[model samples]
Target chain A: MFNIFKLAARNLRRYKRRTLLTSILITLGVVAVLLFVSVSGSFKAMMIGQITDSMLGHLQVHSRGYLSSIDSLPLHLNMKGEQVVRVKEILDGNDAVEAYSMRIRLGAMFSNFTETTNVRLNAVDPEQEMQTVPMLADRIIKGKKEGLLAKGEILVPELIARGMKVKIGDTIVLVATNKHGSVNGQPFVVRGILEGISGPGGRDGFIHTDDALALLRIEGREISEIAIRLNEMEQMHEVFDELKGQLESSRNKMDKPVFEVHTWEELSPFFNIARMIDLMTLFIKIMLVAIVLVSIMNVMVMAVYERINEIGTIAAIGTGPGKILSLFVAEGFLLGLFGTLIGVVISLITIAGMNAAQISFDFGRQKGLLLSPTIASGEVIVIAGIVIAIAVLGSLQPAWKAAGMDPITALRHV
Target chain B: MTLVTAKGLEKTYIAGDITVRAIRGVDFTIEPASFVCFIGPSGSGKSTLLNMIGCLDPPTSGFLEVAGKDVTHLGAKESARFRGDHIGFIFQDFNLIPVLTVFENIEYPLQMVQNWPALKRKQRVNELLEAVAMKDQGGKFPNQISGGQKQRVAVARALVTNASLVLADEPTANLDTETANRIISLMKQMRDEFGTTFIFSTHDHRVVKSAEKIFTLEDGKLQQQGNGDNHV
Candidate 1:
């Protein structure tokens, strides 16, 4: 085995230029794949983070009818009812539950003296809001941040503030509408501008609990939605399941109001698009590996052809065609192994460079900055497996050619 | 016992509407440790006969027994192993693997066939290189050597596995008169030292003169046998 490998190594060294050229092609393919996979990973992370941190949280608990009809305006999901509190208690008991908050959301028009625009208004308890929506901190700009928490003070996104011609310290008159066809008006002081936040929540207006209660004229209504946060991003499903089971059990025993539990995945179905991008990246990697396989096949074929006479001579000396075939196959495997090592090193360097460069992204409304390699170690191992499989498969034809050589003809070849 | 025996050996090749017979109805035997040569004009089937005796080519029809094993239609892998254990070959063009140095080329068969220890292979390569008077040139690649030196390396490579018989197919064809004579003499000396039998297909009198027994062929059939004359 060792002798055959040595011979293969020596033969490869004989044509230094060809070997170098093939290695370069392999390296290029690896680089392209690494960049695609890494960037796609970063994009996926950014997208999911944006959705969960800004809007959906990890899970949402709302009244079943309320979710079915957006016209259920100023509607309270009754999450503060006994049954809802039982579910929340169960979730809060779970070690996975990092944070939980109840909020009332409504669509309304906000007007300052000169202008008006329709916007979503969220009424949140400021203390619990920090745990469920940390991204709100990211939105505070051009004003004191305390306005997000202060009683009867409202925070407006840049878009809403611009449309309303309002700024901090300005009073905006908000008219809240409900399914009962009643509209009530309340005036609130604009506290801050959510400077860079984009998307539905960012473009809408938000207020403290007391202010929203005053605007909606609902003094003692049930809480609208229960938003949850998990210790890790992946624990959302398990926690949601536990909370759902608790809610179901409580509902069976009592004639209380019912709520639907929604995980972040369902509330934000577009998360599937991020996964699709990952699949697409994987497909591209497969194609690239195939190309590398073909390139390796060509290199092995040329190596076999060049060593035709040597193979014949070895066969004549009774080395066995099996041994000859194994030698060439081993050569191909070694080439792939070496190329994969090179690829891994190059990928690490490129990832490090990208992270060092602190690349930022702005895709229309979505914004993000990537500062590290998003490729997991498991994914790297999968890539290695792919490279090896390609190498071994690529070696088959060349090894067969070497093994099938006719000793007499090979010896006679000039 | 006869070292090689063939009965009614035959070979046929098809080349697009033509059947070419390279060897036909040949029966022969060779004794152990004999310096033998098959001599004939081109296309007379001397090389084909050598290939059959060396077990490099399977006989189309008939029995071929080498070292008491019948291997008339051995598979490629089997034949290669058989040859590695029992036969070696020297070619006209000096088929030395170009990438390997003289010592490495000589050590190749030992490593591939014998599974010899590294120390053993090293010792055998050194011994063969010294025998060929290429002790100082063992580190040089085949291409870097003179024609005679290349032939010497080829001889050393053939003998590296300690096979009982060596087949030389017009081994001197690529060399000038002086180099050819030197290579022939070295092959003879190697045969004497190792007691390895040598079989050659040659038109060179110098090679024939070195053979103890000579056979002539014509049109895929053996023509005659004689004690070669001491010419050249």
Candidate 2:
């Protein structure tokens, strides 16, 4: 076996120019795939971090019918006092849960003395909200990140603030209708202006929970939803499943499920775009396969054709057909192996260079966000294995043909 | 004992309704440790006969045996194994693999066909290189050597597996008169030392004079048999 590999290597070296060209082509294909996978993977991960950490909070729980009418911020679908207590109990018992924020979502009318417009608002406790969605303070473009929002204070969306010509420390009036057909108004100081994200919750403002309850005339601890953070982001599904199973069994007077748990993927529209990135990565991998197949097959076929007399001499001297087949296949395998090694090394160096340069780009209203590209070792191994396997497959036909050649006829070939 | 026996051998090739008979029915037997030659003009089936005897080509019809084994109808794998075990071949063009050193070229049959251990294979290859008078040139490639040296390397490669019968098809056709004589002397010496049978085909009268026995063929049929120095 070692002799066969040595002979295969020598044969590849016999045609230096052809071997180099084929190797370069395969190397380029590998480099293209690895680089794309790393860069696009980094982009997707960073964007997901921004969305989940700033707004979605990894997972969310709501009253059974709340999400269906979430856009309208329906007060009638809010979880009552006892239901909220049951949901908290379930969340608090799960070791995976790191923190959670209870929120009251409602639609209100915002006025800056001259202009009035509809605005969606989330009422939260500043400390709990910060723990559940830590990046929330990072999105505060114009005010303090420490306090988030105090009682009687609100964080206005940048779009709404700019449109109403309002700024931090300015007083604004919010008018809202309660579920009982009563209307109330409250004036609050603006604490901050928030940068908008790209999807569903982009235009919502924030306020303190105490202020929200007072203005809505709520008598008890009713809440619209619970946003949850986990000890590890990867544990989102496990915790979500456990909580969902437990909450599904909790029932109201009608004996229907009282709560629905959702991961950030289910709640955000950006996941579709993430899936698109994955699909594109798959297509790139397929293209890499095609490139390896054609290039290695072409080189092996030519090698067989050019070495007919040598093959005949070996075969006539009693070298078996299997040995001949393995010789050619080994050449193809070596080609893939060399190319993949070089490509992976170059890709790693390039990724390191990018990180050193601190390449940054803007996504939506987030500016100068650092892009860190990285590839897992397992991914590198899988890609390399694919290339080498494809190369072996590519050379099989030509190698078989070489092995099965009639020695008498092949010897006569000039 | 007879090392090779072929009775009523025949070979035919077909091409889209046309038939060509390269070798017709023939009968012969070769003894162990004999130096034999098959002589014929062009298109006289000398090579076809050698190919059949070497198991490189199957005869269309005949009783053909090598080393007391009937090889008239062996499968591809069986034929390859049989050839590796009992027969060696040297081609007219000194068809040494260009990519290998002379030492590696000789080691090929042992390593690839017989799966010999590396240390023993190296020792045997060195022995053959010395016997071929190419011991010092073992590290050189085929193209780096002379035509005679290349043929010597081919000779060493053929006998490396210790095959009992070595067949050379027009072995000296490409060499000059002096080199041809030297190669023939080398083969006879190898046969004397190893007790291996040598069979070759040649049109050269000089090579014919050295053979102990000769069989002459014409139009794919055996026409005459004679001892060395006897005219056709």
Candidate 3:
């Protein structure tokens, strides 16, 4: 085996240009597969990180009617103010719950001068919301926490703030629709500019807890949802089970009657679509690998045909058929092996350079999205294994032909 | 003892609709260390008979034995291994592996049949190169060498395994008279020194003159066997 291997290696060197070209082709194919797989993986990781950490906590508890609302009503979870406190306490006791908070989501309109736009407003506690969603603090571009706590003060999304022409310290009219379909209007002062959530359709505006209650004329109303942030995204089910067990054992009638659970995966279907896209990207990668396999097979066929006489000579000189087969197949395997290594190195370098350049693309719907590159070691191993398999499979027919050749005819073939 | 003995050996090849009989009911023997030649015109089956004796092809029927092994019914790979271990061939056109240098080409059979150490392989290759008077040209590829020099290297390559028989098919048909004499003299000298039997096919009377025993082949049958001067 070793002798034939050395001979095979030497033979490859004889056709230096052809071997190098095949190696380069294999490298390019491998890089394409690795690059697509890695970038899709990175995109998935980034999107999940954003959702689980900054927007929807690991899970949320909402009222059944509130989830599918046809009529505009305050279908709150109907947990009393004390019940909200108790639920938060129960969640905070669990090890999986990194933090917990409550929010009152309402639909309202913000008006400044002559402009008015409908906004989904979230009224949250400053202290607990900071623990559940750290981006809340990161979004505070101006003003202090003291000012955000002042009644009748609000912070607005950058897009809505820009359109409303309402800066810090400017007063805007807030109109809230009550459960009876009547509107109540109140004046509110903008406290700060919020940033970081950049899509065109994220929630538009946010007001403080006391100010939103006054505008809606619901001073004694219960909170609508309980949001829990788990330390690990994978722990959502475990924590939900724990929460359910706690609620069941407690004498909490309201918590049992109206609450429903949701993880971040359910709240946003974008995560699911992102996962599906990742699978599709892998499929495309497999197709490219198949093309590489075919190219290698073609090269092997040419090589076997060209070396027919030589194969016969070697066989006539007492080399075993199995050894000859190993030799030819080893040539193919080495081709794939060399090609894959080159491809991996090229891909890593290219991806690194592209990432260093910070290249961004205007993907229309996902404008200003940056193309990020990433590949874990495990993914590299899988790609290498796949390319090797393709190379061996591609060489099978030609190697068998070389092995089965008749020595006399081959020697006489000129 | 006779190194090769055959009786009623027959061989037929099918080419499309034409079934060509290259050898028919032939009985022959080649003694050890003898310079033997099979002389005939084209289509006389000299090469075909050589192929059968060298174990490159199987005889169609009847008893055929070389070095005491019956090869009439041997399988393809078995015949190949048998030929590689026991026989060396010198074709009219020198069939040196073109990609390999002369030294590597000579070392090929040794590497195939024997698990010799690198030192042993190097020593054997150099010794054969010296015997062929190609010591200085061992590094040259077959294409880079002259026709005569390539045949010298081919001789060295074939004899490197120390096989008991060397079959040369039209070995001198491509060479000038002087070069052919030199090649025939080299084969005779190698046979004398190593006790290697020489069985070659040739039409040149000059090649036949150098052989101690000669066989006249016509229409795929052995017609005559005599001493060197009988044809002359």
The most accurate candidate by TM-score is 2
Tens-digit per-residue lDDT, A1-414, candidate 2: 788899999999999999999999999999999999999999999899888888889899999889999988899999898888898898899999999999999999999999999999999999999999899998999988888989999999999999999999999999999999799999999999998998778779999999999989999898998999999998888888899899999887999888899999999988999999999999999999999999999999999999999889888888899999999999999999989999999999999999999999987776788989999999999999999999999999999999999998899999
lDDT of 1 by residue, B27-72 (tens): 8888888899888889989888888888877789988888778989
Candidate 1 chain A lowest-lDDT run of ten = A196-205
At residue A349, what lDDT does model 1 achieve?
A: 88
- How does model 1 score by TM-score? 0.89
lDDT of 1 by residue, A179-237 (tens): 45679988878788876443334455568877776766765655777788888988777
Candidate 3, DockQ score (0 to 1): 0.47
Candidate 3 local lDDT, A243-327, one digit each (tens): 7766655453565444566777767766677879777977877786787678778888988888877876777666767777888
Docking class of 3: acceptable
What is each predicted model's overall lDDT from 0 to 1? 0.79, 0.92, 0.78
lDDT of 3 at B150: 84
Q: For model 2, what is the alpha-carbon lDDT of residue B108? A: 85
The segments of candidate 2 whose C-alpha lies over 4 angstroms from its true place after superposition are A251-256
